[model samples]
Target: MRTSFSQYIRFQKRLLILYAAIMVFISIMLYVEPTMSIHFSNLLYIHAVALIFLMAYLTIDYYTIAKHHKELSSRWSNGMFIQDGIGAAKTYEQQLYLEMLQSVNDAHQQQLTSILQDKKESMEFMTTWFHDIKTPIAISRLILEQAKENPDNESILEEISRIERSVNQALYFTRTDHFARDYFISRTELDTIVKSVVKQFAKEFIRRKIKVDLHIQPVVVETDSKWIVYSLSEFVSNALKYSNDGGTITFISEEDSGEVRLSIKDEGIGIPQQDIRRVFQLGFTGTNGRVNRKSTGMGLYIAKKILDKVGHRVTISSKEKLYTIVTVHFRKGDDYYSIVK
Candidate 1:
């Protein structure tokens, strides 16, 4: 926007002093023509042309410098200058721009880091809170059992038991995200753990008139007992949830190569082909879940998480109208032979 030489010029004081010195030298040369030049007219003409060219060059240079400075200033105003131009800030404009950009980027990064830290802290708090709440729930269940004989409020007791189960599910779901920290690998008795979990569902099996077929041998393997128990429990619970009254559920364990596999099969309303793969996703309740509104869709997700932590894998297969089978494969290690022996 600055068109004139004086308007675009910077360091005005220095430019003016230099111009004045040049003019004074030229004037002195003209006055002492006898000593400086024989043809004074031609000399004066040449000097005038040289001074005009010098002024024109200065004006053009001033405009180029001013245009770049304006651009730099606009970029700073819009907060777009977030990195230096890979060189030292030589100009006054460049120095200001570099400092502004560095400050903006530093503040932005700090804010992002603080937000992430807050989220991590919140999740940690929830995990601890859920763990602490479970102790009281278990104690309350014990107290209710002791008092059940005196009162005829069977429904109330059942509801309390359901609450306890829901709380357990929630706690397990919360812990799934931190599974690596909780797993402890050791030799675990397959038969004992399976029997214990089956016993927990005895009342449901009886109430539904469902039969259980246990084809388990005294198999042992190196794994996390708590996680394995929970995983197997989830499979069994799912079987019970979908199986018709009088349907049979089968529990089997076998050894092959260097590994052990446990499977749960149920004569239930089987999953559709499309839904089998998605069942393990968090909060993904399939079509059957829509029919059975009580499904939280967290069970299998937590089961998979627990299994993976202890180096185990789970697979699901189902026949549309007949049955669903869940198989757990435990990894073989040096401890397997010793435990089986």
Candidate 2:
């Protein structure tokens, strides 16, 4: 807290020594050579007075520096660096530094805000586009449903179902960032969600002659219903895509230790051993996808993402050319968080 004045006083040893030498020389001259001046006594008296004044001046100066230093130090610490009481009200150099730092902070804050705004706008546009495009897909599905009486419309209906699934995937992917605000978490029955997903794929199941073994126990778990359904649908879609005619796809659920495990097992050409560990990677199409040519490689990736956000775990076990099982484990007391990427 010591000011420039106090620092100079403490550090001016050379000046003090020079003053002491001069005082000694004058006192010696006045005392030993009284004849050198008729006013030698007067000279000695004046010298004594000057010495007293110098001591008084230095004492007052030190007190001023210490007092100023204490006041400024307290203000500097508590004023958050930019308070006018600390900088602008002080000297010009301090005010200049304060303004420079403030400018940099403001610019940095503005840039961060701009980046977030752009990302939000882009997500909003994607959501709107997905919704708008669904209107046409819905009309097509309705037309295909009416044409079900005609034997020739089976293929078209199946194709439209695929299109609907793709659109749903995109819609959910866009909404992932807004899950905390968009989701409604509650006690949802496993059977209900499984049944809805199966119903959506009824046409594909029928065409492939695939059998569904649903052993869901109507067990209620706490989670976002819509998102859980979407995740289940992805597994079902994968099962249907890879399973052969007359093959069985099983949806089974069981609860243990206040946790529920839902498994979707299919007797499809399972993922190759080499690619099994990497199936969850975004846009990673493995050996099956290479063969099918229709795999976007996003189904399981998005499923794992949504499930992970809701505190659910997804894992896969498979034997190439035999079977594949995708399991979702739901736990208790998972609260939703609006995490930013």
Best-performing candidate as measured by TM-score = 2
Models 1 onward score TM values of 0.65, 0.68
Full-model lDDT for every candidate: 0.79, 0.81
- In model 1, the clashing pairs are none
| Model 1 score (lDDT) | 0.79
Show model 1 residue runs off by greater than 4 Å: 1-109, 149-152, 334-341
After the best TM-score superposition of candidate 2, give how far the Cα of residue 259 lies from its true spot, in angstroms: 1.4
RMSD of each: 11.4, 9.2
lDDT of 2 by residue, 1-341 (tens): 45676576766577678888888887777767858663767876877897898778777756754665576687777864434444333446556866787888779879999999999999889889988999998898788788778887888877777888898999888777777777777878778888888998887788788999989886888788888899989998888888889999998898887689999999989988999899999999998899889688899899888988777888899997899999998875555443212
The TM-score that candidate 2 achieves is 0.68
Please state the error at residue 142 of candidate 1 in Å. 2.9
